[model samples]
Target chain A: MQIVLAILVGGAFGFVLDRIGATNPNVITGMLTLRRLRLMKTILLAIGTGSILMFGGQMLGLVEVGHMSVKAAYIGVFIGGLLLGAGWAASGFCPGTGVCAAATGRRDALFFIAGGLLGAAAYMATYPAWKASGLLADIAGGKVTLGTVPGSAYAGIWAVSGDLLGIVLGLVFVLVAFVLPEGIGGGHVQEMPAE
Target chain B: MTLDWKLGGILLGAVFFAAVLLVKPIGVSTQFVILDGIVADAVSPDFITQTDEGWTSTNAYMAKSSGKYAASAAGPLNYGFVFVLAMAVGAFLSSMLRGGVPLAERRAPEIWRANFGDTPWRRYAVAFAGGFVVLYGARLAGGCTSGHMMSGMMQTALSGYIFAAGAFLAAVPTAMLIYKEG
Candidate 1:
């Protein structure tokens, strides 16, 4: 039953990602460079909408706080995130989008997937060294929320209600998404390179 | 068959919310590690062993979480792994239903062409290298964009916001430097 649900859920997620142009390297790079704001707007709107729904649902007891999974805060995570960003800009494909692109018949994505596997293997080989580096040690309260939810295991960095904070921030993103122009300078038409 | 970005974004949010509400958050990077572990165990019989105590690995990282990683690798049919595989299937199906990949995706994107030329091999090489770097970083950070930024921030986790800041701090400058023509 769970596997079936996984297929349905995963399918919906990938389908939405592709439709949003995330499977296209051009779309990704375009967003990164601020040359095209379509994908960026979509991403922000999605995150914002999801946040509002999630936090709102939690507050209403329609969502389970226990299901919330907070990743541990560590120096390695910050460093690794920087690295991931560089790579994301270079490749224009993150892990999920890479897989989805390959399914869309983008041959380049297959190579990306291959490289990702090799990279994972390399990390596995060097896991011990990373562990010894102390970069993975917990920082702040490892696995903490910015604000407290009633039933979660994580500590809150602030005394405010996390649900309310999330909703407010989500609204801000949604507003930004709507107000942002397609391109800077009032959607100035830039000459796109020849296809 | 194509939806506008606004509708697409909303649907994406709906999917994410439903997943988190029903089961758990959506994450993809750890599956890459799981794939690696599965292959390693296949090639080296002793890499993973199942005892009465549960699954264990000679590799310390895999052996952590009370051998949870090793168990997933040994089983290879868990929820996360299946979800990733299904993601590919979903994408393919979406393309097919839309009458195959759109022309924009079939060839090199215009911006890439503007900067990198129209060589397929070069794009493939860069794509691979980029994927490698991303996966390595994800493992080190213990999550990827989906796991950390999207799901994490949705839950109002401070780590998610920090990861987002770190990502954009490097990504914007890197993108600007590489695609100077754009």
Candidate 2:
């Protein structure tokens, strides 16, 4: 039953990702290069909507806070993220969308997936070394949220509740998405029609 | 007809909500870890055990008995793997429905060609390098875009915001450098 639900949800997730033009390398690179804003709008909208639903649901008792998993903060993550960004710009696909692009029959995507798998294997092979180096170690309050806010109970100067703050930020994202002009580089660059 | 991105966002959010309600937050990088475990297991029966001390050692998250019974199962074939495989299948189906194939002869886009060139080998090489860097970085960071940017940000985790900022900060400049105008 759980596996079945996973398939259904994962499939739906993939479908939505493709439908939003995420499976296209050009669309992704365009967003990164500021040649397009569609993908940005899409991502902001999705994140904003998710924030509203997750936090709002929690506040209303419709969603359990325990279900939400927060990742830990560390210097490694920040530094690694900068590298990941460079990778995304270079390859035009992040890990998730790369898989989707492969499934969608993008031949280059298959190579990207192969490369990703090799990378994962390499990381595992060097796991002990990285761990020893403290590059992979969790630091600076692992699993922290706005509620915890690291050293203080409140985040920033407003002293708003964490959940409330999240919702406000989400709203801000939505507003930005709506306000940003579309097709920054003249118009949307359409990829070869699927095939 | 393809859904507008805003509508797509809502649909994606709905799916994520359902996933959280039924299972846990959605992520993809851990699936690679599971793949590594499976590959290791295939090569040697005691691969994971020897490397990680125990089957459950590296997979404590999946081994834990949670709200769902399937969550307690131990091994690489856990829920995360299933979800990722399902995503691939879903993507294939969606592509076919939209008149796309599982493989395209011409893969790289105009921007890629303009920046890199039209050579397939060059494209593949760069892609492989990019993949290596991204995945390596993701593991070091404990998550990738979906795990941190999507799921973490939704939960208002500070790491998510920080990572997102770092990603764009580096990506924009890197892209500009690579694709400098003539």
What's each prediction's TM-score? 0.94, 0.87
Proportion of native contacts kept per candidate:
0.73, 0.68
List of clashing residue pairs for candidate 2: A105-B102, A105-B103
Comparing chain B with the reference, what is the TM-score for each candidate?
0.92, 0.80
Candidate 2 deviant stretches above 4 angstroms = A148-159, A186-188, A191-195, B50-74, B101-106, B180-182
**Residue A73, model 1, lDDT:** 94
List candidate 1 stretches off by more than 4 Å.
Answer: A185-195, B102-107
Docking class of 2: medium
- Give the per-residue lDDT of model 1 (tens digit) for B43-102: 998999998989999988888888998999998888889999888888888777767765
Which structure among the candidates has the greatest lDDT?
1
B1-182 in candidate 2: lDDT tens per residue?
35676897778778777777778889998676667656655666544343233334343322322312112223535678888888888888888888884233346655666656677787888888888888877877778999988887877787888789888998877766765421
TM-score of 2: 0.87
Model number with the top TM-score = 1
lDDT of each: 0.84, 0.73
lDDT of 2 by residue, A1-195 (tens): 888888898999998888888888777777787877777888888888888877777777777666777777887788878978888888888899999988887777778778887887777667677657776556555667765322333233234566677788789878887888765554244543443
- Worst window of 10 by summed lDDT in candidate 2 chain B: B64-73
